[model samples]
Target: MSELSPYEIAFLSGGPTRVAQTALLALYESDRIRVSRGTHRVEVLPREPEDLHPVQAAVIDQVPGTGRLLGAVLEAVAAAPEVRAVADALVSGGLLRAGLRGALRPTGEGKALRRGFETSPGEGDVLRLAALGPEGVQDAKMREILSTDDPKPVKMPKKPKGGHRDLDSSGLSDTQYSAGL
Candidate 1:
């Protein structure tokens, strides 16, 4: 499998311009990798493995949840300024295409560049919540799950035995009942 250089990886990760610049600088310093910036695409030659920078790792970590928006990726990376710079750099390098909503999405080349940063959730990572029945109904199963050994007594309002009615008729208008006086 062909590997991606640090610069390529940074550009693909998608962040502010400054962050991409820093990543590119780091990649340039390393001899194992080569970079090609063009209007059509940014290509990385002779990709090599290197320790991931903290910023890159953060962005990668957050990508799964916030891949839809550049701003979301910035929030994940917690680098506001860097996110903007990286976004500009990626667009300039042809690593990403600008969308109608001012968001950046990975191009074909960009996907290949981010292979090393992929991650998956591990086993036993269950999300626990109160199980609800259909339409938020408190079904028997839900009730069983929620019921405790010492359940609190539910206080129900007492209803009038003879139904609601005014005991005193002092304010009654003759026209109200239309009864013969």
Candidate 2:
């Protein structure tokens, strides 16, 4: 990061309304760039600047999912009502350019937005399943393990052996048994 002046820092930190003033401060801070603030303003700084505009870089970095809504970008950066003011300042300063669907893109900004979804507790299950792949073999195994019960057989009470003696005796006679032999 380049060395920031107190005025520049104050201007940048003074909410989104002071974005134009912040840009001017940033331009003044840059050794390779000069700016003039007035009607028919003309000022020549140096060329081939080594550093880029910080505010524009930050705005670009906040943009996500390609061609994002202006309001959404503002909310993402927590800039709220000041977003339009800051955006207008950046546009006028030529530090930012509007892209498709009114999305802001930084000029000469490198690797603006960090691409990825935030990891939250709510997404744990989704991330786990995604990591496991679409086959769901791990899920099946987990379900099987969870559904298993104790491996024990049920026991029944024993009945008296003589309980059916009368019925058995009625079905046969002593003469029939002797003839069978």
Candidate 3:
């Protein structure tokens, strides 16, 4: 298989939330971008002959005041500058396309990506491993298997027979899923 581009990795790893979750990580994955981390904030530093997508670079350029770091930006609301910029970048950069006229009009690319993230095993390995964080992997073997920036192949520890995903919280079956939708 061919290698994943940084943008592709970010989209498959999660989505807008995943990109937002580690803005710096996602941004810095591209050779054109660098991150300057302060005690409480970060700056999105761009390199000359920028290798980033036009949309991504443009959004980074518009991020105000050295970009307010990763943590704060991730926790910020939709209207916040960074969140707004990232959302725009996601669509313009082709990770997600614009929806139709309505407020909830789903875009074609967005729907396909969402389905892959939720249902494609080949695509969801990193996502599931990410969900099962370091704390979730109590065993050294699992931890060793999961610790990597770009995992080429992964051998996930088999789920227990009873279907409890982890010990931290009660695992919910399909019927028990929240929101009662």
Candidate 4:
């Protein structure tokens, strides 16, 4: 099999989430996208490259004008039709199989590609390390995204118990009702 692209390697190593995360890392590194620290919001910059992969483009499109949360962007991209197309293509090419727990199992060719990538990764493959599931990633930016960049949790107000006021507080009692018709 021919050498696989970083996207292919990322999918083989992990799954759609990894693909999305790797694509985001690439875009971030290339200045195609901007990730807000602390809040983890993502926004597509103007003058985006025209040669982006479908998955990368999808990620950009997924972000709204106001920007989206990092975790939301990752989830959106992972489930996007473009990313699914990549998985479908790989499966059609006999390089991947659907394994237990929705995991992607690589075929022989896929295995060889992964072996090659792990053995001698190409330049700028450091961003792809996040696709490998947080291990072997040394880049500060990549590690920051993987470790600290997540959507901030919404702070919901606590609900009152029993959902009603006390019956004793009412002026009337159950026994006080008239039974006469």
| Model 2 misplaced regions, further than 4 Å | 1-13, 37-44, 56-181
lDDT tens digits, residues 53-101, model 3? 5335444654575555433444442234544454555556555554465
Q: TM-score, each model?
A: 0.27, 0.22, 0.34, 0.73
TM-score-superior candidate, 2 or 4: 4
lDDT by candidate, in order shown: 0.39, 0.35, 0.42, 0.75
In terms of lDDT, model 1 sits at 0.39
**Lowest summed lDDT over 10 consecutive residues: which window, candidate 1?**
125-134
> Which lDDT value does model 4 have at 157?
43
Predicted candidate 2: what Cα RMSD to the true structure? 31.3
Q: List the residue pairs that clash in candidate 2.
A: none
Compose the digit string of candidate 4's lDDT tens values, residues 1-181.
3545667667777778888888888888788889877788899888835798888889888998899998889898898998888788788888998889977689888787677667765566443463355455667766776666576575544447846545555455576465632
Give the backbone clash total of model 4: 0
TM-score of 2: 0.22
Better of 1 and 4 by TM-score: 4
Candidate 2 lDDT tens digits, 4-56 = 22222222333342332333223434532232222112133535635454553
lDDT for model 2, please: 0.35
